[model samples]
Target: MPLSDDALDQLFREARTHSAWLPKPVDDALLRQLFSLAAMGPTSANSSPGRFVFVKSAEAKAQLKPALSPGNVEKTMAAPVTVIVGMDMAFYDYLPKLFPHTDARSWFVGNDDLIRATAQRNSSLQGAYLIMAARSLGLDAGPMSGFDAAKVDETFFAGTTIKSNFLINLGYGDHAKLHARNPRLSFDEAARIA
Candidate 1:
């Protein structure tokens, strides 16, 4: 069944990319819950490539600071948590467990290009799922692609097969600080029917 109007509004219409935050903290359990909800979203062949790093500690946040563009730094630092959404290149290794009906892992084992493409595409979808999951849980999100991905990968995913895709600052938003909601393209302008 489709969600009710209120649920839809909370997840889309009323949802904004929050730039200012309330002076509140996001609990670890809530973060875990957000991940659990997001993980349920689908991906091709069940290749769950998204990996998240919740940068909540001051030290970790500091490590992340240098990679942020000037515009993203202040709001990112002020938020309760900044989630580094990354794509795991070796995600196919878990296919035996995630998509266990057959030998799915063998499909990508020797195909670097296919693995890279699938990982990037599915992880981006998973990041979108994370945004919706956060909204459903009454948290605001600011998804940003302004940061230096290579720097973020070096700082956060070094020695791992993960590559940073984007960042999301998560917290209770201060509605008063939001700019007016901008106009969106109408369906006719944004979509096409074959």
Candidate 2:
């Protein structure tokens, strides 16, 4: 069955990209649940390359600070959690477990171009899933790309095969600080029938 109108409003129409957040903290359990929800989104060959880093501690935020562009710094730091969504370049290595049938891994093995493109695209889709998951859980999200990816990888992923994709701030938003919602393209203007 389709979701109710109220559910659609909660997940889409009424939801906004929030920058100013309430001082309320997000629970660890909720974050874990959020990931489980997001993980259900599909990826090619079940590559599921998205790796997230939840930066909440003062030290972690400080380490993330210099990487953020000037405009993104304050809001990101003030939020309860900042997720560094990274793509695991070696995601194909797990196809044996994730796909579990035939030789799905062979499709990407030794093909650096395919690996990079697929990892980037699927991880971004996962990041969008993360945003929806946050909203579904009564949290607001501010997904952004205004940061230095290399710096973020250095500070957060270090020795891992993961490479930073984007950042998303999550928490209870201070709606009082919200600006008027921006306009979006109407379906007729943005899409075409074949």
Candidate 3:
């Protein structure tokens, strides 16, 4: 069954990109649940490539600070958690386990361009799923791409094949601090049904 209008609004129309967060912390269990829900989202060839690092500790936040742009530093530090959404270049290695019914790994094993494109595209889709899942579970998300990807990868994903794609600050948002909602482009201006 389709969700009700209120449910749809809560997940989309009323969902704002939060900048300021409440003082409350997001629990580990909620983070786990968030990932569990996000993982169910579909990916091409079932080549699930998204990897996440939830930065919550003060030390970890300090490590990530150097990579953040000035405007993003304060809000990110204040956030209860900052999720590093990444793409694993070696994602196809697990295709045997994730897409076990077919010889899917062979399709990407020797193709760098295909591997890169698939990882980036699917991981991006997974990140969006993460945002929606968080919202559905009563949390706010602020997805940002304003960091130094190289520094983030070095600091968070060293000795690994994962590359940072973006960052998302997660927590209970302080709605009082929100700016007025901006106008969005209508379907006529932004899309078409060819």
Show the colliding residue pairs in model 3.
none
How far does residue 23 in candidate 3 sit from its true spot (Å)?
0.7
Estimate candidate 2's alpha-carbon lDDT, on a 0 to 1 scale.
0.95
lDDT of 2 by residue, 93-157 (tens): 89999999879899998999999999999999999999999999999999999999999988888
RMSD of 2: 0.7
Clashing pairs in 1: none
1-194, model 3: which lDDT tens digit per residue?
Answer: 99999999999999999999999999999999999999999999889999999999999999999999999999999999999999999999999999999999999988999999999999999999999999999999999989999999999999999999999999999999999999999999999999
Give the TM-score comparing model 3 with the true structure, all chains together.
0.98
TM-scores across all candidates?
Answer: 0.97, 0.98, 0.98
Model 2 misplaced regions, further than 4 Å: none
Name the lDDT value of residue 97 in candidate 2. 97
Task: Give the alpha carbon lDDT tens digit for every residue of 30-126 in model 1.
Answer: 9999999999999999999999999999999999999999999999999999999999999999999999999999999989999999999999999
